[model samples]
Structures are given as structure tokens and as C-alpha cells.
Target: MKVAMIGAGYVGLVSGACFSEFGHQVVCVDVDERKIRMLEQGEIPIFEPGLEKLVADNVAAGRLSFTRDLTGAVADAEAVFIAVGTPSRRGGGEADLSYVYQAARDIAGATEGEKVVVTKSTVPVGTGAEVRRILAETNPGATFHVVSNPEFLREGAAIEDFMRPNRVVCGVESKHAEQVMRELYRPLFLNETPMVFTSLESSEMIKYAANCFLATKITFINEVADLCERVGADVQAVARGIGLDRRIGNLFLHPGPGFGGSCFPKDIRALAATAESAGAPLRIVETVNDINESRKKAMAAKIIDAMGGDVAGKTIAVLGVTFKPNTDDMRESPSLDIVPALQQAGATVRATDPEGVREAKELLTDVVWCEDAYTAMEGADAVAILTEWNHFRALDKGRMKKLLKQPLMIDLRNIYPVDEMEKAGFRYVSVGRRAVGN
Candidate 1:
């Protein structure tokens, strides 16, 4: 199968490379000349695990390629996937679909006979319908099938997720579109990955609903962590107990500074706005969004309180500034709020992440960036673990204690056990558990 991916950003690049790996000849198109040049030079712009290898392997096999020539790419393919970004509109939750619409128009003009247009980007419902309308209006009497095939790949584990997805969703109104999609993902058929067929609107809604629900779960657990602190209970124990129940299973139940990533915050706001427009506002989701935002700032207060209610003239080491581990994405990371809040409260911040510093440096200001975790902690008053990066999970407690001016630790991700910290003879403050080693 021949596929043309419109937009060589994260979704398009990954999906295009994976499709090529599946024996499909894929051409990834992008308007950004610099990005396309980078891809062609074997320099990936994003920091997704194993993505560079995947792209390199496929390109070497002559199954995948990148280009800025949208017309040429689209004209040569049977399927055109719009994998552009639909970021939140300025000061609102409605998705900014300018890029998507532009792609539709370009694809409409460039597409050859019988092309299946798939929306692999996260979009609001009715977006596919609008794309279809734009395609028809752009090129009259063109045989194009627009599909809503929202991607569900996690950043750090995108390749694995794509190769072995829990399920593949396709929104098709016609048998032709359905068959084309099925053939494109025919490899998944061997793995027995469930194929969900639904309406365009349903497919779009599934992406938003899934992310919002996960955000809610994270927010719910964070609130529970607070309550556990007040009532002298352990949130970890409570979570474990509830997670054992089949109905409640234990993902996204771990408490932290809050959920802050590319998907959760954007999707929650978008869904909330969509619901409000439809006269069916989601109060719970709205509250979760509000709480999660406040929660990030509140984590700075927790650090202050750990320093005996004053962060003035204090130096705090923040390990892991990325939203999560194994990626350089700093979009809406909690550290964006927490670091600045700490600075506002007169605390000097020293932060480091394995892969996030390059991107984080652009968003975060007035903070000392370090090369590694230990370097960040050197001479700091206290150490705070923001993102649970793998190396931070088993850091040298003795070395951290020696490097810090005081033996104080705030484990926001609760990666450390309370009893172990107590045994280590260091003051440890963690979420959903009693402070140990006073």
C-alpha cells in the first residue's frame, strides 16, 4: 500500500515510519523546510524512544521518506493521513484546526484517484465532516473518503504502542473507506489487535473522552492523597486496596503534582468547551482541569512548607522537569508552574532532566539548568522529585544527602518508601504518606 502522511510532526513521522515498517511505502509531507531537511539528514526533531531507529531502519529499507512537496506526495499515494497538530485555541478549549483545514485543501488539490484521507490527529468531533466538506469544495467531484482515525500512542512508548496497540479505531461512513483502512492495518490482523469500526464523530469523541477520563483519575488520586494526609492514612495503601478491585484497576491512580502533558490538559479543556457549547457541560472534567492547574502551583507551597514555611533564600533541586520520563516534551509540564512558583516565593531553582533540558530551557526562565541529577542537587537546600524518570527512581540517597546542605527530600511522585527514607536517617516528605525522619 502507498500512503502519504500530511504533517511530519510527531504523529505523522511516527505513524509514517511504522506504516513503512509494516511494508507500506509512505511519504511524510511537511511545509516546514527545516524539519523536512532534518528528517532527510537523519536528524529527528523530536525525542521519542526508539523512533530514530524506526525511522532510520525504514528509510534504509526504502519504504519511508520525508518531503516538503505535498502535491507530489499526495498524488502518488492511495491514502493521505492528516496528522497535523490541533492545539487549543488562544484562551479557549476549541481546537485550532487551521493546519488541519489547510491540509485538507492541499490534499484535495493534490490527491490522485480514490484516496482515503485519514485524520490521525486529535481533533474535536465534526472535524472529519468539515474536512470532507472542504475537500469537496476544493476539488469538485473528487472521490475522497475522509476518516477519523485518532492516534493513541504514548510519547515514551510510541513505537510499541503503534506496533502492538490495544486496539485500532477507524471511523468510516462507506465500505470503500473501511476496506482501505483494514488493508492499511492488515498487519494488526495477524496480531489479533481488535479493530473498532464506528462513526466519525464517535471516533473523535473517543480520543478526547479517553484522555479526559485519565486526567480525572489522576486528579481523583491527587485529592485522595491530600485526604489521606489529613486523616492520617496512606494513599499508596488506599490506592493499592482499591486498585485490586477489577472495576477500578490501577493505572493513573498514582498521585503526583498533577497531570500535565500534551494530551490531558488540551483534551480536557477542549472536551469541556465542546460540552459547554452543546449545553451539556462536564462539571467533573472542568473541576479536574481547574484542580490540576492549581495542583502544580500548590506543589511549590508543599516544598516551601517542607522548608519550615519559608523558601526565601533557599535553593531547591528539582529532578525531572519533563511531564513524564523518556521524552523531551515540556508542553504544560507541572515543572513549568512549580519551578516559577518556587522562584516567585524567593527560592532559587536548580533543575535537570535526562532529555527535557533542551526544551525546558525555552519554557522555564531564571532557573539554573544542570547536566545531571546529582549536579542539580549539589549545594541545594532540598531535593524534590517532580517527574519519575527511571534514574531518579533509584538515586544514591547517601550521595544526595551529602550533596544537599540539609538532608531534606520531597518526593512528589512518591517513588520512595517512607520507611526506607526513615531508615536512611533523612527527612522525607512524600505525597499521600506521613512525613518521616523528622
Candidate 2:
């Protein structure tokens, strides 16, 4: 199979590489000449775990390639994947489909024969229909099938998710399109992966619904964590007790600053806009968005309150700036809100992340960026763990105690145990739980 992935951002680059790994001849197309050049030299522009090695291996084997020539890539490909971004539009919260539509126009112009045009980007319901209409209008005689194939790859674990997806959902109108999709995903068939065949609208809805539901679960648990704090209960034990239930099956139940990444925040907002436009608003989703924003903002206050009702003239050590660990994505990270709020409140902040420093430098300012967590903590009044990076899980308590001016700690991700932190001679504050050594 020959696959051409358009818009070589995170989704395009990862999907194109993974397709090549599956023994398909893949060419990734992007408008950015520098990014394509970087890929040619095996210098991945994005920081995804194992992605560079995967691309390097496939390129070495001559199965994968990158190019700025979209027409050349599409003319020889069996499947053209539109994996461009669909960010939330400013002021409206609706998904901006301009990029997707432009990609469709480009693909339509470049497409030669019968091609399976798969939308690997997350789009709203009826987007596939719109894309198909655009393609037909651009090239009236062109024969192509627009299939909705939304990606469900988690940022940090995208490679693992793509290689071993639980199920592959594809929306196709014709049997011929279905067969092409099956052939494209033939590797997953060997593992008996469930391939869901549904209507284009349903396939589009599935992606938004899945992301919004997960966002709701995170918001629910975060609210529960707040209740646990007020009632003097342990949220971790509470999460475990409910997670053990077979029906509930614990995931996204951990209480944290809030759900913040490339997907949830934008998807939920888009979903709400979609619902309202259709005359059936999803009030729960709207509330989830509101509550999650409040949660992120509230975390700054939590840190300030922990530091003797004031952070004025305080130096706080912030561990982890990325939205999550194992990836250097700082999109919609809680640190984006917390760090700025702390600075506004007159606190001098020092931060460190294993992978997020470079990207964080672009988004965050006026903070002392350090090489490691302990270095960031040195001379700080308190230390706050925003993202649960693995290195932060096993920090030397004595060293942490010696580093900070005050033996205060805020575990926003709840990575550290209260009893253990208490035993280490530090006052610890965490989400949805009672403070230790108060």
C-alpha cells in the first residue's frame, strides 16, 4: 500500500511513520520546507517518545520519506490522509475547519486516480460531507472516497496507541472504500483488532464524544477531589474504591489541576458549539469546560494559600511544565495558568521539566529555568509538582528538604503520598485530599 499523509504535524508525522513501519510505502507532505528537511535528516521537529527512532529506522529501510511536493506524493498514492489541525476558533469555540478544507482542495487538485481520502484529523460531525463536496467542486471529474478516520492517539503514548489501537473506526459509504481501508489497516487485522464500520457522521461524532466524555470524567474526579479535601477524606483511596468496579473501570479518574493538552479542551468546546448550533445543547459538556478552566485558575491560589496566605516576594520551585510527562507538549498545560498567576502575585518562579524546557521557554517568561528539579527547588520557598514526570516520583526527600527555604510541598498531581511527605519533615498540600504536616 502507498500512503500520502498531508500536513506533517504531530498526527501526520506519527501516522506516516507508523504506516511505513507496517510495510507501507509512505510519503509525508508538508508545506514547511524546514520541517521536511529536518525529517530527511532524522531530526524530528516534534518531541515524541520513540518517534525519531521509528522514523529513522523506516527511512533507513527506504519505506518512509518526506517531501514538500504534495502533488507528486498524492499522484502515486493509494490513500491520502488529511491529518491537519482543527483548532477551536477564537470567540466562537467552533472548530476551525479552514485547514482541513484547504488540505482537501490541495488533495483534490493533486489526486490522479481512484483514491481513498481519509480524514485522520479530529473533525466535527458532517465535516466529511463538506470535505467530499469541496473535493468534487475542485475537480468535477475526480473519483475519490472521503472516509472519516479520526485519530485516537494520546500525545505521550501516540506511537504505542497507533501500533496497538483497541479498535479502528472507519466511515465509508462504498464497499470499495471499505476494502481499501481494510487493506490499509491489514496489519491490525492480524492481531484481531476490531474494525468499526459506521456512517461518516457517526465516525466524526465518535471522536468528539470520546474526548468530551473523558474530559467529563476528569472534571468529575477533580470536583470529587475538592469535596474530599473539605470533608477530610483521601481521594486516592476513593478513586481506587470506585475504579475497582468492573463497570466503571478506572481511567481518567485521577484528580489533578485539570485536563489540559492538545485534545480535550478544544474538542469539548467544539462539541458544545456543535450541540448549540443544532438546537440541542450539551449542558454537561459546557459545565465541564467552565469547571476545568476554574480548576486551572484555582491551582494558583492553592499554591499561594499554601505559602502562608501570600506568595509575594516568594520563590517557588515548579516541577514539570508540560501538560503531562514523556512528551514536550506544553499546549494548554496547567503550568501555563499557574506560573503566570504566581508571577502576577509577586512570586519568583523557577521551573524544570525533562523535555518541556525548550517549548516552555517559548510560552513561559520571567521564570528561572533550570537543568533539573532539585536545581529549580534550590532556595525556593516551596516546591510544586504539576506534572507527574517519572523522575519526580522518586525524589530524595532529604535533598528536597535541604533545597527549599521552607519545608513546604504542593503535589498537584498527587504523585507523593501524604504520610511519606509528612514523615520527611515537610508540609504537603495536594488536590482532593487533606494536607499533611499542616
Error of 1 at 46 (Å): 0.7
lDDT of each: 0.93, 0.93
**Candidate 1 stretches greater than 4 Å from native:** none
lDDT of 1 by residue, 136-155 (tens): 89987678898999999898
| Candidate 1 lDDT for residue 64 | 95
* TM-scores of all candidate predictions against the true structure: 0.99, 0.99
Q: Which pairs, if any, clash in model 2?
A: 225-432
Clashes of each: 0, 1
